[model samples]
Target: MGTINTTTNERFFVDYRITLNDGQDIKKIAQEICIEQTVEIPEDCVPQTHWDYGITGIVEDIIPSDKIKNQVLVSISYHCDISSYSVPQLLNTLFGNISLKNNIRIDNLRVPQSFSQLLPGPRWGIDGIREKLDVFNRPLTCTALKPVGLSSTELASMASQFATGGADIIKDDHGITNQPFAKFEDRVQRVQAAINEANAKSGTKTIYCPMLNDEPDLMKKQVDFCLKSGIEGALAAPMLIGCGAFVSLRRQTDLILMAHPAFAGTFFHSNLHGATPAFLLGRFFRLIGADISIFPNAGGRFSFTQEECNELSDALRMPDNNILPAFPAPAGGMRIERVSEMYEKYGKDTVFIIGGNLQQLSDDLSVATGLFLEAVRNCACATKEIL
Candidate 1:
């Protein structure tokens, strides 16, 4: 076992699930990873000078799992300098070539404080978001504007209604991009204006987070436009745009970043193929400056298990040095009727994002949105009483 250390040269830990092929040697496979992840050369070919300088990955342990035959859990520690504190390099060093091999999955990863501090984490996490919303002691209600064909005016109208009906945050759908029907700049300006009007009328603090997924230059322009329009945050699909894009946005502006899980499903779909939902949607996203990490909820249109959902929630809220807990926004097929159940399951520091159900509930968007907020309030009160 590797002892806990706080040195500048601390090591990063990676946990992988390795399934042995017929008659394949476990020790050999472990050594193969140690070579591939770091030196990318045969062990014997590696120069003694490189090994002496701590440039090689060390296989800490490999324990066969009793629950599953032919499966073993391998733990490896790599010297922190291998990544040079860069996100792209870190990912490359962690799973670059190994990702191509079969029967191998990255299960978990741990970065020491020295390396973690080098990354730009959440700027306005749970507490900052709560302060902005001014709704303490209750899970915040969020909604998305959707059905890609709508024009900028139509989308702005929907945003106004959502704010008027008391949604804490209104976000653009992941599909709402720089399309003809709703150009990015037009949609952002119109929707933010509408949301501001509704807030002025209702005296509510509803934040509008515009969706931004463009080239680096275009993304920066969109962010600047939103900020100039008095918008407080943005919704970014980190998987589609890349982690580097998300981190750059964090460093450029203090906007609240709500990470949308658009292309991230592959990472959590299989229990034995890729990362767990907790690590990808929760810890990793939070580490890269996502104030709110969104994921598909259990019993939704998606197939995430209840245990997986709980684990994701725990990962987002767990304590870490200088890393604030983010809001785990449970979305996808969410409805007004499930607010109580979701509230009980996720506790108070969650953001419930409902969409299609709200549109289907009533002809009037405001009426449906009001019902959703009422359900959230009722759930908060009921939970308090039970406690």
Candidate 2:
């Protein structure tokens, strides 16, 4: 059964794939999810007023699958009030306790506009980012300043070269925090200066995105520092910093938020356990105001399949009611030689991140960056010619 529309009550729907044990009653599992997700007590124990007001998870539909023995698809709807208009709370309501139970996995969630509208969607989505880069016709090029031991000056030099060679966005490697080798404040100031200098020289508008990984108060200060330094964006790992923390940052600043996929693998490591890559990296990240979602690309060092990558990309770009689309930055062990292949698979709206490969390809960072830019442009031209 599909989603049910109820105008009488605003409900957010969650779809679950439940694999049953032999002789296990399917109705009992559905009822357990309903009670556990909402009131967390026996159904009869729930207050009558609360029940009338839709505070309980209503099992809208359940269908048994013949393909898999004891496997059933269940759709449960919970009133929007259960979420308190918070991403973390919403997540809790969706699969907080049920996640601990075996053989139950969240397949998808359909958020209604009433609840979704209160959240911070992307401030700079696909169009906004393209406008900032002024590269409306081609896929955007991105690279990371890496090898964490480098001094602020050294990292700035790398930023300048990448920016000068036509990289649209230059971000600090996720491994870079406030380490002594390159202090956060010093690194951001120097890198922003270098990128600004390069942009001035080349008449290109390359942007620098620093990583923000401090505590809440300090992270706010870092965001302010970036804004004051004329930096337009920053990278954040929601899994490391809590999702609530990321949402707070989104509410406070207009900086382009690029979500990093560090420490997120555990959620998708098991087939029957955690959420899918599409849900975490694409749907949820975009909903939480990530203008760009970076994930380990298929055929890269990561274990994600090509089908999973395509599904994640669709989740990022596909239209949701009012939520703007985010750019899918497929990275992680991507090589310079694979630009054409990536462009063909992901199309022009993507952001291709090539990092260590640039250094491996050429000793001169500027020359290697140039080759990457040329490959991307060539692919765009060929795609256009074909069309």
Model 2, 270-385: lDDT tens digits are: 76667779888988888888999999999999999888899999999998888889999999999988999998899999999999999998888888999998999899888773
Deviation in Å, model 1, residue 31 alpha carbon: 1.7
TM-score of each: 0.94, 0.94
- Model 1, 1-387: lDDT tens digits are 233232355688898888887999988988898899888977889887667666788889998976457989999999898887778888888788887877777767788877655565799999999899888888888999999999999999999999999999999998998999999989999999999899999999999998998888887788888888888999999889998788777877989999999998887656666777888888888888999999999999999998889998898889888888899999999988889899889988999999989999987888888999888888878767321
Worst 10 residues of 1 by lDDT: 1-10
Which residue pairs in model 2 clash with each other? none
RMSD (Å) per prediction: 3.5, 3.8
lDDT of 2: 0.87
Evaluated against the true structure, the overall lDDT of model 1 is: 0.86
- Cα error, candidate 1, residue 69 (Å): 3.7
